[model samples]
Target: MSNPHPLQVERRGSGVPILCLHGHPGSGSAMAVFTEPLSTRYHTLAPDLRGYGQSQVQDPFEMADHIADLEALLDREGIEECLILGWSLGGILAMELALRNPQRYRGLILIGTAARPRGNYPPIPWWEYVNTGIAGLINGVKPGWQWNIDTFGTRSLFRRLLKQHTPTAYHYLAHAGTPAYLRTSRHAHRALNTALRQGYNRLADLPTLTMPCLMVAGADDINITAQSSQETAQTLPRCDWHCFPNTAHLFPWEVPNAMNETIHAWLRQQNL
Candidate 1:
C-alpha cells in the first residue's frame, strides 16, 4: 500500500488513549469541544484526516487509504491499544478499524453513523438545489462568497434545521463557528463519490464484531436516520444504543457535554 499524508493530531491529558475522529467536511478541531473535556481523565488524540484541516491533501481518498493512515498514526504514537469515539464518517472508519484489528481496540463510541451504505445514490433534496443556486449567485457577486457559503451559510442552514429538532442544541452549534480548514468542497465530493462507487456496506459484518460498542443517534437526524442505528444495535452482540429525542445529526456538536458525560459513564461501566 502507498503511504498516506502525515496526520496532524491534537493531543491533551494523560491516561488511557482515546482517538477521536470527525465527520466529512470537518477537521479534528470540530471535535475539540467533545474531546477536550475528557482530557482530565483520558489521553485524547484527535487527528485531521487527509485533505482536511492541517493534514496534507492527497488524491484518491479511498477508505483503504484512511484505514492505513490510522494504522500509521497508532504506530507513530506507539499506542498498543486504545478506545475510539467516532462521529458520522469517523464512526464508519472506526467500525472498519475494529473489524480489521479487533484486539487493538478496547471499545467503540459511534454517534450518528450507519453500519452500511444506506444506498448507492441517495436522492438529493430539492431545497439543496435552491441553496446551491443562491450560494453560487452570492459567490459570483461577492469576493469571499465561497468562504461565506462554506462557513457561515452552511452552519446557519444546519443550525436552522437542527433548531426544529433540538433548540438548545442548535444554539450550541450556532455559536461554535465553522473552522476554515473544515470547509472543503472538493474533498467532501471526492469522499462521497468514492464511497458510493465502492458500494460501502458493513451490515453483514456487524454481527461479527465482539468488542463493546456504544451506538448513539439523534431521533430527527436527517442524514443517517435513527432507524439505522437501531438496526445496528440489534445486530451487535454487546452494544448500548441511545437515541436522543428531538436531536439531529450534529448531536455531538450540539450537546457535547451530554455526549461526553454519557460516554464517560459508559466507559466506567465497561471498566475500559
Candidate 2:
C-alpha cells in the first residue's frame, strides 16, 4: 500500500470550516464534541487520522504525513481555509500545518499540543506509550482522597466511572459470567509502532503564525501541563488562552460546558 487515506469524514454546517483532529488511543468518534455544538453555526470537518479509529492504516505515519493527508482532505472538501482545531497529537499537527502553510488556516486551536522551540514543552518520551498515559489518566480521574493506593486506599468513584468509556468505551465489560458486544482493540499497535520507530523533534522550522488562536487547557491536565498550554498560546501571535481550572487532560469529557462556551466565543470571534 503506497499510502492509504483516512476513514470516513463528515462535513456539516455552512461557514469557515472547523476541522477537528482527535488524539490517539481512540477513534475520531470523540469529535462528537464539536460536531454536536458547533455544527449548526459553522461547517465542521472531522476525519480519523491514518491508523486511528476507522481510518485506513497508512505507513510512514508522522506529523508531516498527517499534514499532507489533512491538506488533501481539505482540498477534496473544497475548504480553502478553516479554523483548524486539534487535540493532543492532532493539536501538534495543526500547529505544524498552520506554521508551514499559514494561508491554509483561518485560525488555529491548540488543545493539549506544543511546538518545542516556541513552547517549552516535552514530547511524549515514547509515543507507543501514549496509551499508558491515557490509562493513568483514566485511573487518576477516579474521584479519590487517600493518595496511597498501595496502602490500601480504594476510592469508590472509580468503581462507577470506570465504565465511562467501556463497552462503547472499549465495548464489552459486564456480568457475573456473561458477555456483551466485544470491543476490538484495533489499529493501536500499528500507530504505536509508527510512533516508536518514527518521531518528530523539529521546532525552529516553524513559521511565525498570526492567526487568531484559542488555546484551551485543562488546569489539572497531567499529561500536558498547563504551562505547556500557555507557552503554546504565547507562540501564536494572537491567542486567547483559557485554562479550565477543574478539568483534566480529557477536558472535553470533564468540562464540556466550558469548552462549549469557549468555542462558541471563538466562533463569535471568527464572526461565523
TM-score of each: 0.82, 0.71
- Compose the digit string of candidate 1's lDDT tens values, residues 205-239: 98878899999988877777888777887888899
Worst 10 residues of 1 by lDDT: 173-182
State each candidate's clash count.
Answer: 0, 4
State model 2's lDDT.
0.60
* Model 1 residue 6 distance off true place after TM-score fit, in angstroms: 0.8
Candidate 1 Cα errors over 4 Å, as ranges:
117-156, 159-161, 164-177, 180-185
The regions of model 2 sitting more than 4 angstroms off are 1-6, 58-60, 117-207
Q: What lDDT is reached at residue 158 by model 2?
A: 19
> Top lDDT: which candidate number?
1
* Residues 39-70 of candidate 2: C-alpha lDDT, one tens digit per residue: 88778888877665556552444444677778
- Winning model by TM-score: 1
